[model samples]
Target: MDLSVTVDDGVALLEMRRPPANHFDEVLIGGIVDAALGLDDDPRCRVIVLASEGRHFCAGADFGGGDFAADHVDAAARLYRRAVRLFEVRTPIVAAVQGTAVGGGLGLACAADFRVAEAGTRFVANFARLGFHQGFGLSVTLPELVGRQKATDMMLTARRVGGEEAYRIGLADRLAEPGRVRETARALALEIAASAPLAVRSMRATLRGDLAGRVRAALDHELAEQRVHWATRDAAEGIAASLARRSPVFTGE
Candidate 1:
C-alpha cells in the first residue's frame, strides 16, 4: 500500500509511505481518499493526522517525463473526483508538513482542517513556474486558507513561503521545532479527538458549508486551463528550464 492507517486513542494516523519527494499520482490519491473514507465510518476514529514519511511532505506530481499530464484528461478528472471525496469526510484532519509542500502537495495540505509545520518547512504554489494552471482544487482551497491577494501572489510568483511566513499568513495552524511536526500534529488531532464526535462533526460541517461543492467546481476550471496551457510552447520551455535548474523565458505564444 502506498499509504497506511493506524488508530489509537480515537485518532487515526494516515501516513503517506512514498519516500523522498512523495510525488503523487491518481493511484496514490485514490488510496488516500479510500483510507480517509474508511476511517470516517469507523466509530473508533474521531480525528485523523495526515503525515508523510519522506524528506519532503509531497512535491506534487512528477512532471519530469515531459508529459505534464501523463494520463491526460481522464486521469486528471479521476484524480479530482477522488480528491473531492477528501472534503466530504466527516472527521477533521490535521496535517504534519515537516518539509516542502509544493504544487498539488500544497493543495493536499490545505485540504486538511489544520496544519503543523517547522520553521524550515516550505509551501510553494509552483504552477505558473511550471507554466500550468493549479490543479487538485487549489484554486479554491488556496484563497480560502490565505485570502485572495496572498493566494494570487503565490500563484503568480511561484514564491516559496516558509513555515514562519506561512503561520503569519494563516497557512499553518501550529509551528513546531524541527523533527516535532508530526508530534505537534498528532497532539492537535488528539485534542480534537477529545471532543464529542457528533458535536465536532456537526460543527465542522457547519463551518465548512458547501466547500466540497466549491472544490469540485474549481477543479473543472483548473483542469480546462491546464489543458490549454499544456499545449503551449511556453509550458514545454518552463518544464525544461526547471529540470535544468534555470529560469524559464516564456514568450506569450
Candidate 2:
C-alpha cells in the first residue's frame, strides 16, 4: 500500500507513503480516498491532515511505464468518485506539503481547506506541458483559489512557482520550514479538532454544495478536452519523449 493513516488526539494524519516522487496510479489514488473518506464515519476522528513521506509532496499522475487512460472510461468515473469522496469528508483537511506539488497533485492540495507549504516548495500544473488540458477539478479550483488571471497564466504556460509565490497566490495558506510541515499541519489540525464538529461539518457541506457542481462541470470539460489531446500526435510524442528522457520532436505529428 502506498498510503497510511495515523490517528492521535482526534486528528487523523493521512500520509501518502510512496517514496521519491509519490506519483499516483489509480490504485494509490483510490487508497487516498479510502484513507481520508473513512474518517467521515469515524467518531474518533475530528480533523484530517494530508501529508506525504517522499522527496516531493506528490508528482501527479504516474506516466513512468504505463498508459493510465487507455479505454479507461470506467476508471475515469471511479477517479471522479474518489475526488467527490474527498470533498464529502466532513472534517476539514490541512495539507502538509513540503516539496513539489505538480499537476493533479496541485489538485489534491486544492482539495484541502488549508495548505501549509514549505519554503522550498515548488508547484506546477504541467498539463499543458504534456499537451493534456487538465484534471482533478483544478481548472475550476485553481481559479477559485488564485483568481482568474493568475490561474490562466499558470495553466497557459505550464510554469513552476515557488512557495512564497504559492502563498502570494493563495495556493498555500501558510508557509513553514521543510521540517516543520508536519508540525505545523498537526498544529492546525489540532485547532480544527478543538472546534465544534457539527458546525465544521455544516460549513463544509455548505461550501461543497456551492462549489461541487461547478467543480464537476469544470472536470468534465477538462477531461473531455484532455481525451481529445490524448489521441493527438503531440500528446503521444510528448509522452513518448518524456519517458525516453530525450527532447521531443513534435512536428505536430
User: How do all models score by TM-score?
Assistant: 0.96, 0.91
* Clash number for each model: 0, 0
Angstrom error of the Cα, residue 117, model 2: value is: 0.4
Encode model 2's per-residue lDDT on 1-253: one tens digit a residue. 6788888999998999888888776777778778777888898899899989978899877665433645433455557666756665667889998888998888888889999987799888877767677889997788889999999999988888898999888988888876798898899889888889999889778776757677778778877887787878888777677668776666664
Q: Over the stretch 151-212, how does candidate 1's per-residue lDDT look in tens digits?
A: 99999999999999999999999999888999999899989899889999999999999999
Q: Could you say which candidate leads in lDDT?
A: 1
| lDDT of all predictions | 0.90, 0.81
TM-score of 1: 0.96
| Winning candidate number (TM-score) | 1
Worst 10 residues of 2 by lDDT: 65-74
Q: What is the RMSD, in Å, between candidate 1 and the native fold over all Cα?
A: 1.4
Evaluate model 2: give its TM-score. 0.91
How much does each candidate deviate from the true structure in C-alpha RMSD?
1.4, 2.0
How far residue 97's Cα lies from its native spot in candidate 1, in Å, is: 0.4
